[model samples]
Target: MDPMYQELKEIEHRPYPLQPSPWLMTQVWRDLLFMHYPVSTDIIKSYIPTELELDIFENKAWISMIPLRITNMRARGIPPVPYMNSYLELNVRTYVVYQGIPGIYFFSLDANHPLVVTGARTVTGLPYKHANMSFEKHEETFHYASQRIHTAKKLNVAYQPGHILFEPQEGSIDHWLLERYCMYSFRGGQILRGDIHHDKWKVNRAEAVISTNTLVPFIPGEFIGKPPLLHYSRRRRFFIYPLKEV
Candidate 1:
């Protein structure tokens, strides 16, 4: 069996929120990095919709900056579209709970693929922006950068993953952040959800040097002056279901 399909067969580690199979889309996430910063709970409350509650750990809310390469993207039973199959992406996201189910709420997603940006905005109502981006790996480190076309919000970072990769233990912060299976969006006064699924992340501690990070203009740059918690994963094959109102 294909490794991706083999992943789907092992579901004991997955949470209960997954929508049933016949998932509408699939993609491969490569060289993913997660940079997490802690923020005051009060600071995040105003941004989340009233329909959703902030999902905090300990007593602090978290914001994660994710940089990744997306590939082999295609709808169920469809071949990969030539110009749309691959792209570099940067995401600003936070955690939220909707109707007792914990999930992610993206502040904004910037990608280099024009078709993807337009399609995501139109179809999922996600805040997707087109950007000029570059990605390359030197030795063992990944040098990733992106600058949004509309607003020159740029992010440049170089990171390398440690050799010891392991699954995040349940109840650990890594599990809390990376194990989420659904994403929520607020548009036109309504909340929508897109459910996603993949196997548990096998990640290693990552070392990163961030040179520029004004990707989130709404938040002050000094807010993350302190180093963030970092984790790196080589790849994951993901399946996504349709977006529906919650």
Candidate 2:
């Protein structure tokens, strides 16, 4: 079987069955860093769209800043282009459940590639902005940075994955944060959802030094000042289906 098909065999961990439609594209997220913070539900309520409700974990709302390199990216029936296929991305997102299905809600997504940024914005309806970013690996530790264009928001983080890796329990916070299979966005005065499928995430304890992170300005600096809950996954291959009205 093809490796992409192999990723679908472990669907028992999925919250719902895969979409009957064929996936539209594939990408691999490498050196991914997930920095999560708990925030007041009241603070997040206003940012959320009226049609959607916040997906709370442990009675508190959560948000995450993820910095990753997207590789092996190409649409169905096309081959991956050498330079265009890979780029760095930093996204600020929170969780939401719409019509009983859990999904991600993005506040912003910054990428280093202009074409990819524009294409994602037009194609997926998700927020994708251009930024200057870089990634450097030193043995087990990695240094990643990004500065968004036309805005003062930026991120600088150094993280390393731990030796032991394991699957997050079904109801654990880790599962709640990483197991989401779809994302919701508002475009053209309507709600849009895109189905996402990937193999089980085998994560390890992660430690990060967030020297500076102003990705979500409305989020108080106090939350940024406090240490965040960290998790790391070296890589994960993702298949994203097309977006459509919910």
Candidate 3:
């Protein structure tokens, strides 16, 4: 087996089944900032579909806001498309489990590209919205900003990666937040899951300042105070599988 595959096989705390047979697409995520906050399980469960169970840690549910650069995206065995090859994406997500398999459930995804946004919504049955977004790096800090089209929702954050890079320890809250291997979507009264494969995440403690954050309205919260946990990753490649009904 290839060394990369060998390393992936050694990933700690992977609870889902391995990626099966052929993959649907591949992509790379870069300059990712993960900001997570704890919420009541009752609040989260009201938003998720009835078919899935909310996955929690110590009786608390969590939501994450991730702003990242997406690149090198393409179908399996195909070259990356011209304009759609790269874009900026910000996602708001929570955790869930279906039939004992843990996965992610996205509340909303905002992207700069219209085609990518439409394609993702159509194919994956997720709520992907078009946004005016920008990403830039100045000195050691990276800046990300996004505004949803035709809506007042907006997010602005500036962050820098810390010096120490390490993997989340097993059974820790960081591990629970970052190590999910599959994602769930609901459409037409059916549950769907898409598997994603990646090597264990190497993350750095992150420092961030939030200038404005109107994205909290999507969840059932009146306000989100300072995030409790923040982490950053330089880059990671992904092997993505097609969505399958559960």
Choose the strongest candidate by TM-score. Answer: 2
TM-scores for every predicted model: 0.94, 0.95, 0.93
- Model 3 segments more than 4 A misplaced: 1-13, 218-225
Point out the worst 10-residue segment of candidate 2 by lDDT: 218-227
TM-score (C-alpha) between model 1 and the true structure = 0.94
Candidate 2 residue spans exceeding 4 A from truth = 1-4, 218-222
- Candidate 1 local Cα displacement, residue 165, angstroms: 0.4
Q: Relative to the true structure, how large is the alpha-carbon lDDT of every model?
A: 0.86, 0.88, 0.87
- Among these predictions, the greatest lDDT belongs to 2
Candidate 1, 1-246: lDDT as tens digits: 123476677678777845665688889999999988887777778877878999998887888999999999988877888988999999899999999888999988999988899998999999999999999999999999988997768988999999999889988998998899899988888899888889888999999988888866445456544346899989999888998888
**Can you write out model 2's per-residue Cα lDDT over 3-105, one digit (the tens) per residue?**
4568877798888999999888999999888888888899888998989999998898999989999999987778888899999999899999999999999
- What's the lDDT of the predicted structure labeled candidate 3? 0.87
